[model samples]
Target: MSEPFSLLMAVYRGDHPVHFQKAFTSSVAGQTRRPDQVVLVQDGPVSPGLEGAIEHALADSPAPVLHHRIERNVGLADALAQGLRLSDHDIVARMDADDISLPERFAAQLPAIEGGLDLVGTGMLEFLDDDGSIVGRRVPRTGQAEIERYARFHDPFSHPTVVYRRSAVEHAGGYRPLGLMEDYWLFARMIHAGARVGNLAEPLVMYRVGDGAYARRGGRAQWRSELALQRAFRRIGFTTRGQYLRNVAVRGGYRFVPEPVRKAAYRRFIARGERARRSTRIAR
Candidate 1:
């Protein structure tokens, strides 16, 4: 028999109730090959509506839902770590409370893990709000070599779209409290530990990118965190001093720039047209 997988998700007070419901429904009820277990961590206190949605989704789900709660807000990193501990299965698939996983996502990812990949992620379509119209797509670099190269400057895998072996994560010390760069930090450690990672060429999740998303990426705190991560990469030999400096000069400057400029740059560089083309191809 194939190793069973558990879907791991963390929810907080700030999450929109409607989005949370849709995300839960899509990940659990909509999956063609549903997870054997769903491990949900309540990061902190949530609104009654959000709580109700979780209850409703869990009540309707076919698979078992293991719910864990923290008394106070411990943030994503710690919350995820807690959830990871609670997950009973050897394979764990990460899901964001505000994103929608496509019906075939689990089915597509299971084979990769079965084939000996330690970590696997898929492309994701970024949409605006709850209407689900695709605004952009993140087509991550596939293959171990390409992923390792991209990991030096950027996160090659979309966190919510990734399915990874629990043993691999445990070997890398699991998730740490790294602020906005927590996922990236963990991925770096996993790569350094010789974890085999890859990304499927097709989008498997609908990522919700709100208007203020880019604005939130800027600011001194974010910049400091990013630079610190780069420095850590250099210290660990994942990046050269020259690469670290170049990252600072480029990504660091973006943090100080106006939001409009950052948005424009994001659309031009990070977002790609390939998702639309892929959708078109799938339609025919």
Candidate 2:
């Protein structure tokens, strides 16, 4: 673990040129404990504008850059699996094109990669929009017991904020295509394989939820969620209580709630997260 580790960042052309560049520069170079090497796995052929952002970000990056561009648009699962195959470190951290990392993300996480844990992820501050403005945080439970309990319900940690041991991923059979919820799919498999998982009680990355694919909610999106839940249930040999509860809420409470009321509830969830982080510093 002491030799050095690589950070694998995946960039789909879905991001705007300015925001993508800002995230790459701020998250990679701006880390307090910088990665020894950084890999930018582009999901498809880049646009002229995105190409420029990639160029500038790499040129200015403090870590060595490894750029992999695919001819076609491979989905998230394949892209991340390819990045993991290309990584040469014991630890491989995940990042997204549209999100920013806090300075102490890895510095705070690397030490926790001790003993038997296969992966370590963090709680995250989620941005309400693409402007890096904070909306609220998702505070994940850390430690083997709590995370294991959480996994029985859903994904144990935030997908983009994890630093995982490569060996553990290989054992879990790597990331697979699961339409919209590849990260959750992988997490379920890892837990079933008896890999030790933990979440750091820190907001290492800013997750942009409503700005992208998650912004649209319709039949297709709902179907994808249903499929993801089914996959999770199959993996664990039982239906998830959390998924059932969500369905009940959406079908029952959400049906009666006004659109404004639903939006207000979500905003309050995020704001409350921000308030929680204000009292606890995950850094030592």
Candidate 3:
């Protein structure tokens, strides 16, 4: 028998209703292997349109939907922590409010989860917000060895594409208020605690990259947050001092570069990675 699981997500005022509707439609109504339960956390007061969208999506959902509302904005990390606590299933899948999970996302992830892996995530295709054109793809390192090695320098899994064992996450102390790098932080802790992590090479989610997404990642405040996260990882023995310094030099350099240069560099890197992934598939 297959292991039953719950889907966890958080929404807030800033999320676009249309995008949220698409996200919900894809995650719930569109999944080939449906979740046993769905837990949606309203991080703060949402617009009436968003409320209607949530209502409309749940009106026909096959799984039982549990909607938890927070009186005010508490950010994604805190909201997700609350949702994780509220979720009743041992296997919980994470989804973002504005991204579309492919129809086979849950189906593809279940094997890894049931095969004793503590955490599993898949690659994602990124699309632009304006015309929804394919912008790039993120194919993170897969398998226990590759994932553990990658985790030393970067996030080895896509946050929204991940389906993790609830007990493992809780054992790692669950989610914390770790600024923009909360997911990274949790994964680091999980790895440090010897959690078995894996990644599906196939892209299973359509991630929306807004116009300001790259810019948002390049600011001084975000740079500081990234540096702090790296330092914390080093202190916790998740990453070595040399690795932390290398990460700081590379990641920090991008934050100070011109926005256009940074954007171009990111695009180039994604294009190369996507090409390599496609070539490997063809070779196989």
Best by TM-score: 3
Structure candidate 1, residue pairs in collision: none
Kindly list the per-residue Cα lDDT of model 2 for residues 1-284, writing each as its tens digit: 45477889888767778768767876677888888888788999777899999999888999988998877889888988888888878788888887778899888877777545678998887776645577666877667877777565556677878988888888878898875667876776777788888887767788776632322433455556655656555556644576656644553344345556656766786576556556555542
Candidate 3 off by > 4 Å: 278-284
Best by lDDT: 3
| Residue 216's lDDT in candidate 3 | 87
The TM-scores of all predictions, comma-separated, are: 0.94, 0.83, 0.96
- Candidate 1 root-mean-square deviation in Å: 2.9
Candidate 2 stretches with Cα past 4 Å from truth are 1-3, 114-116, 130-132, 209-214, 235-284
Sort every candidate by TM-score, greatest first: 3, 1, 2
Better of 1 and 2 by TM-score: 1
Q: What is the C-alpha lDDT profile of model 3 across 14-126, one tens digit per residue?
A: 99999999998799889999999999999999999999988987897888999999999999899999999989899999999999999999999998899999999999999
Ranking by lDDT: 3, 1, 2
Q: Which of 1 and 3 is ahead in lDDT? A: 3
Can you give the lDDT of residue 262 in candidate 3? 88
Model 2 earns a TM-score of: 0.83
